[model samples]
Target: MTKRSAGTTASPRPGRRRLVIGAAVLAAVLLLFWQRDRLSPRRAPSEDDLLAASPAQSAGSAPGRDQAGPKPRWVGSKNAGTGEDAEASARQIAEKRLERARHTLEGYVQATRYPPGARPLSEKPDLQKPHSVAKNTLPLARPDHKLTDARVTLEQDRLYLVGDEAARLVASCTTSDGPARCEVLRAEARVPETMPQASTMPPARVAFADEGAGGSTIAALFAPAKEGFGGYHGPIAINLDLRIEGEEGAAQFNVVYTPAPPARLTGDVREVIENGSLCLYLRLAVDKPGRYVVVGRVDDAEGDGFAYLEHNDPLGAGAQEAKMCIFGKLVLDERAKSPFVLRDVEAYLLKEDTYPDRELVPGRDGPFHTTKAYPESVFSDAEWQSEERDRHIKEFTKDVKEAEGELEALP
Candidate 1:
């Protein structure tokens, strides 16, 4: 063999060193990747991810999971008008608002409490009165005719309407009440934008009867709208002629006035009637009368009933939630004089004061003495049983005629 060069000898040093360095670099790259992954932010799983992971979990969730999130739907743009213009969008919004307001007002009237006989004095006779008027008039139309505003008039101790000009007095008639001649008028008018002052004097007596089924009747009088302390100088007189009827007996009633909170007077009266026939006729004059509400209810065993004389707005219409109503039943008449005119007929009825059967009451059954009304039905079972005997005791008091002379002097 030919003699080889000295440098040509196989040298493992450079090759081995190169192999070691390559292995070290590969290990370092893996360590860097692992560290980076650990330091990175750990994002939570999205709904889609969760759903995909477990079908059982997704099924157990509330219905409409996909629909729960925000939807990308078309919305009416600002300034949009009719015929594909921005003004149309604005008009749509306004109409929706008006509809909502009307529904709200209707509810309020349904729930509103009105005192008996308290006139909406000095108000327009053509407008709505506590006893008579169009059912559809609360939020009066705005002056521009585009918006709506509720109006109330206190002329002649009566609450009148004042909204649209189309509403006006239409007719009137005269009637006879025993020897005292009376007038019965039917007026029509529009609702105004605001309410005027309320009458002071409330009705003396309120009776619910005569209407068979699906009918009711209400009548009341109030202090003159311009009258001063008494009924002498008050404003125009106010009256309500409400009528609703049923088959066997018509439920005829009216609201009375008292120096009590309007809500209390209205809410409490209806609640009280839920327990009995609510036949007590009170003729007490108020001490300091401003504005008061009167509410009434007539319910028999079948759950069919009628109510009227409310002072609250949107009477009988309210949220579904339970609410605490005021308790303002002052059995002790505070008119300084005898509050009731005890005629022989009234005396005869008083003498026969027997306890009403439990069937008369809605919730309370069995042979329990009728007295105070229970709280709303949401009370717990334990709570209802706790106060049984004491419920009727407080309201069962004797009627003593101490102020007979004052009652005899009435006109």
Candidate 2:
């Protein structure tokens, strides 16, 4: 009986040992899995994994799924094949540049016509106080010939009249002629000028605005100096023969000849005749020869008023006494409620035989220079004052260094 019991115990021991080994293997496998989970980098689920984890549903009604298995996630990136956005951005930038250029040109024209008080300190000339009109020194003369050979040039969509003969013809037309007569001649001239012509002729003046923008027609006439016109040899009368370019229009405007205070629009001074051009003639009776200003509301036929214009004629020493024609461009807009608003004004000097050959007259003292000085009161804040002071000091130091270098280079 004892031998039989011992045999049974040995068989049970082998079975028990096998069971213990199996348990140990299972624990080791679990530990390896835990270590891998803690140490290895986690990866986003693949498309297949996502599909397997998603709840089972009808193929047609799956969540976040279209006809395809899954909807594509959109990342913020531009497609290589599509360039429409880039092209549109570039076009907008180009348009802005063109607009800035046009405005700058208009401003220059207006600056030339600014009055003494309105002008920058550097450009302002000496003038006498307000005084009564003296005897006229020059007799008014009109353009005798018709502008038959004038031609038009379209640049940047703007129309400019070009032709020496045409300029001479228009310059000859006397402002004394009633506005109706002047308008007739001007309209007649435009008819032929608008037609195609040779491109060799020099540009006389800008005649019309770009398409869809407003247009203007201007003719400046000079009268021969009389015995006492001003104290010097300048023109006795300056006739601004102007008409709206596009359609027939009219507006009430006042012409303020500086030294003489601003005056109301009187029939004798401003008359709107049937033809549409406003014939503005200024008879000079000043005691000296210097710069003068003419300010007023001279509207085009479309009710667009003249903003500003600059005219500089460098007459030959000998011909300064003769009648001289000055051509200039001006800015006009319907947005300007007051003709007195001065912005982007400039004056370009025109050269002609009647005038001397000289450098173009400087319109303003310096680029970005203005008559108004910056006030120190603006720098009341310590931070702002400090920053500005530092900037000015830096500029001054740089200027001094440059001067020293220039001096060293000089003999």
* RMSD to the hidden true structure, all candidates: 29.5, 29.8
Over the stretch 81-141, how does candidate 2's per-residue lDDT look in tens digits? 2456545433443344334334333333233332222222222222111111222212222
1-411: candidate 1 lDDT, tens digit per residue: 778787687556998989999999999999998898666533223422422332122211222223334422224422223544544433443344334334333333222222232112222243222223343212222234543222211112212211110112211111121111112222211112122333333322222222222221222332212122122211222232321110111111111221121121111111223221223332212222232232232222332222221232222322111111221221111111111111111000011233210001011112111124433342121211113222321211110121232233333
- TM-score for each model: 0.15, 0.15
lDDT of 1 at 196: 36
Off by over 4 Å in 2: 1-276, 297-411
Best by lDDT: 2
